[model samples]
Target chain A: MFETLSNVFTDNPLIVSFAIIGITMYIAYKLSDKLTRGRIHGSAIAIILGLVLAYLGGVLTGGEKGLSDISIFAGIGLMGGGMLRDFAIVATAFGASFDEIKKAGMSGVSALFIGVLLSYVVGVAVALSFGYTDAVSLTTIGGGTATYIVGPVTGAAIGASSEVITISIAAGLVKSILTMIGTPFVAKYIGLNNPRSAMVYGGLMGTTSGVAGGLAATDPKLVPYGAVTATFYTGLGCLMVPSVLFLMTRAIFG
Target chain B: MVIFGVALLAICMLIGIFFGEILGLFLGVEANVGGVGIAMIMLVLIVDYLKKRGKLSLPAQDGLGFWSAMYIPIVIAMSANQNVAGALDGGPLAIMAGVAAALIGWLFVPLLSKGGLQTEETVEENTFIGGENKNVRNIK
Candidate 1:
């Protein structure tokens, strides 16, 4: 009877994947609410947990697909594939409101542009100093500075090596974590007291999870405004990084 | 009725991906560019248009809500798919680049916020209501 039930679950890999994610989310949120008192958002905590699991899976299986390398967890490969990841991200825009977006105005718009550019510049300089002189690597890593999602997307689109793409992702993850932890500490000093400033902050920060989590800590009220612009920032980064930015990097580095 | 929302999302996604691929082709890139982002923009636009037309029903809204709620889980899965261990093996360059970008971005916050158009008093009331209502609805 136990073997039959286990076989049934293993046969339906996606279902098993969902169950694992569900349990992970439950634990992550519980940790957020009880342990951290919601100072850190559940999503950030979940990502950390997921990363740890991935690391462990890599060690245990000595395989590339992380936890999915284990047969029972094979569904994780499909669940975490690009298709579903893209679908979930696309679905998030449903919650956005045009009326709310209009409130941010010109400053918010310019902040997005400036934010992407500044991050790219900083990322490129760091990449160069680290002796990664190739245009593809520089552009991909620069895009990663914009956001983790952008990093991988740009890298793949421009045919960058898998190693470079992974590094780019790691770079983006570090940015997201820092943004989450650093927001509240610097909020008052930066005049992040109002919705407008929050919107500008979001546009500048560009990482949605980071901005959302940080704003939640600083002022729960500011999260929405920051989130809206941060979403736009991601979209803008996605559109810009692989095309125009890649061209620029090629021009300079070549 | 909830299926209608899913259908709508599917239609928008198809169109978005098509355009994204076209954009990629134009730019000479092999991979799809901004497909997900484009789909998101389309969903937002389409939903807003439907809402304004009063064509969106409660069930359809529920469908959107269901998927929106799935956001955290999907993000977790995506993060899990990343090769963090491999990235770490490449050394501290990745970590340095990320920290530098974040810090420099933070340093510019005050400069960007200095000359904003709206005063806090006038913009406060309307934005507060909109922001709070959104938070309640999304719950993320």
Candidate 2:
């Protein structure tokens, strides 16, 4: 019976992958509720757990792609691929009513541009301080400050070195983790208790997972509102960073 | 109803992917254009329109809700698989740039959060019908 069950899971990798994720999420949420008193979002804990598992998988298998390196966990790679990632992102809009969006008004609209430009400028300045003068590298790293998705997307578009692209991703990831952990701590201080404020905050932050996780921890009601604008922030970043931002960086540095 | 909602979502996704490809071609980028974003917009508009018209049932709305929130944890996990190890090897400068962005971005929170009250109606609405009483579970 044990051999047959193992064979079943091994044959249907996706099922086992789902089972692992399900169990992990259950434990993560339970820990969040009990240990942190729901201060740290379950999603955040789950992500950390996933990363740790991936690291261990890499060490044990001596392969890249982490857990997917193990044959049984291969489904994780597909499940987390661009297709589902994009789908999940897009699905966020379903909960966002246009009427509620209009309620956010012009402040929400400007927040997106302000957030992107601000992050990009900071990213460029930091890159410069670190002695990177090339236009491609500067723009890519700057885009990373905008969001993790934007970082890799912009880097690939501008043909940055793999090392630089990886750095850009790291920069974005750092921003994401910070946003995830910090939002709850600062929610009360920033008055992020309402949907409108959440929408504006999301626009300013631009990291979907961070905003969602942060808002989930702060107030689950705010997650959809924040996720909506964060999604827009990503689309806007992808649209602008490679074109307008890249040109500006080149004109300045080259 | 659930099946119908799922079908709608799939259709919107396909169209969004197609539109994104066209957009990428036009922009001369190798990446897919805002396919997911566009699809999401379409789904929202269509689903809401149907809901407002009383065509969508409660069960269908619930089904959409379940699917929408289902993948979030998985997505978060997938994102962790990014080439963080490679980025760490990009030297101290790269690490500094990343750390600086995160810190500076955090600083912006205070400044960005002060957008202020827009209209009297919104404040009233939030206090009366919004605020803590408005649950995320009932968003659909």
Candidate 3:
């Protein structure tokens, strides 16, 4: 399936990278389950979403040629998932009923707000210190959800530099570590006032959060999906008009 | 999944860097970073809506969450692209960069949170032994 990817990296680095991540996450997920009670999380929805984006990006980008190709916008969709993920976070927070929000570990929107607030500050500070003010992206926004809420480009613009591209990458690393080393602090912040200040379920949690929230509100499950659709549509903002211009030019000249 | 994420990202960024500057100037747009952000949201929405409605879901948005996690590695790897990736190349550097960033988060988060204990849901117990089980501690 990824033979083309094989030619690109050292004996197909990209395919190997994906295989490694999938296998590792699977093992980690399994090991975590074994080590603890049945508190393990499954990522059915997120995995489904990731694969769809990948295939389409590969297809659309490859077909485009001129400076005005429509597929350039498609490429943007891949990097911008962080922001889309946050929209999911926001929808779940606002859309969820009082009961559902409680189930998800938020007494109300305030707790969710605290999490987002902390993430945003941490995200920005890391970017400034590293001089990567323009290098961030937020593909999966909720767990640490900083750049995700702000949107990927916004994160990157906040953190980008001539130096790096994952300004939120700095944010992500900090978030993962906090779940471990800074457990006391996180426990205090995320757990204080309300024990359910934030839920750390990951991508699947993101799905569940949205689903549960919508279910509580009696909204369609499709609403969360709508955010992604709007983001991509807007993401294509500049690309749409120009590609036609370029296409017409080529057609006339050739 | 992240492998694809990283690979796709690397491809786009590399391409964008070459053309992003030109495109940015011409379009009067910010860096194309915003474009990518907008795109992911659109991809997810289109994919979810189509599937539930019995229409075709975009292949791109399907299963994207799994791949999104790979973003960590991509960030780490790309951080070192300029140093070049040979055997045993970016492993240590990424770790160092990550650790440094984390230390700041750990140190600063507490300071930023400042006296969040005020937000405690319940009062603290002053004493725990012998008839001194007071929920409120009085210091005189």
Candidate 4:
């Protein structure tokens, strides 16, 4: 009976994957409510937990694809694939109000450009300090500072090496985690209380998941405004990093 | 009825991904660019239009509500799939670059907030509707 049940679950990995995620979410929420008194959102905790699991999965299986390396958890790879990720992100916009978005106005628009440029400059400076003199490596790493998505997209467009692309992704992931954990703590100080400020914050952050998760922790209502601008930021970064940013980096470094 | 919302979302996602691929091609990149963002824009437009016309019934709203709340879980799952360990093992430069970027970006928030539109009354009005009521209930 046990073997049959195990086989059944493995056979229907997607269902098991959902069940596992659901249980993890429940525990994470409880931990947030009881342990942190809701100062930290459950999503933040869940992300940390997921990262830990990913690390452990890498170690235990000595394989890529994290937990999906295990046969029983194979469905996790699909569950976490870009298709579902995009679907979930798109679905979040259903809650945003046009009135609120318009209220963000010119400040919101400017924030997007400043955010991308600022991240790129900082990324390039760091890459230089690390002794990477080539424009391709510098541009890829710099773009990663904008967002993980932007990093790979930029790297691929400009013909960056796989190692550089991986490093860029790591940089973006760290930024996302920082944004998620830091938003609630700084919410009050930065006046992230209103939709306009939220939009500005999102534009500055530029990482959609980071901004969304962080704003969710700060105030659920702020998520849509922040998410909308952050989404735009990614699009802007993709357009700018490979062409304009790459050329600028090449000119400076070469 | 519940499926209607998901169906709409699926349709929007398909359209968005298609456009994203086209944009990527135009830019000479091989990856999908801003597909998720485009899909989101479409969903928001469609939902708002439906609401304005009373075409969105309670069931459809409920369907969207379910997925809206599911955002966090999905995000968590997506992050789980990323190879954080590999990145860390690659080098400290990645960490340094990321931290500097995030910190500087955050430091600029106050400056950006200073110049935006000033609507004290609107902020107060929205606090009631946006902060406390419908959207937040499902989150906690």
Best by lDDT: 4
Interface RMSD computed for candidate 1 is what? 4.8
TM-score between candidate 4 and the true structure: 0.87
Cα deviation at B112, candidate 3, in Å, is: 18
lDDT of 3 at B29: 42
Stretches of model 4 off by over 4 angstroms after superposition: A1-3, B29-33, B115-140
Instruction: Tell me the tens digit of each residue's lDDT in model 2 across B1-140.
Output: 67776677778889987987788777666555556656766886797678768887766665565556665555555644444344444466556665665556456655665644443245334321211233334211
For model 3, the stretches where C-alpha displacement exceeds 4 angstroms are A1-9, A40-254, B1-30, B33-37, B44-140
Give the Cα RMSD of candidate 4: 3.2
lDDT of each: 0.73, 0.69, 0.29, 0.78
Residues A1-254, model 1: lDDT tens digits:
98998798789998888999989978987998899897666666766787778777777877766677777887887787767655655555676544545655577789899999888888889999989999999999998878878888898888999888888887887787678667776877888877678778988888866775566556554654676567567667877889888998899888
- Candidate achieving higher lDDT, 1 or 3: 1
Q: Considering just chain B, what TM-score does every model have?
A: 0.73, 0.70, 0.32, 0.78
Compared with the true structure, what per-residue lDDT tens digits does model 3 show for residues A111-153? 2233334443443343344443222222112112232123334
By TM-score, the better pick of 3 and 4 is 4
Q: If you assessed candidate 2 against the hidden native complex, which CAPRI class would it receive?
A: acceptable
DockQ, all candidates in order: 0.39, 0.34, 0.05, 0.51
What TM-score, over all chains together, does every model reach? 0.73, 0.81, 0.30, 0.87
Q: What does DockQ come to for candidate 4?
A: 0.51
User: What's the lDDT for residue A159 in model 2?
Assistant: 96
- Candidate 1: where are CA atoms >4 Å away? A1-6, A102-112, A131-254, B113-140
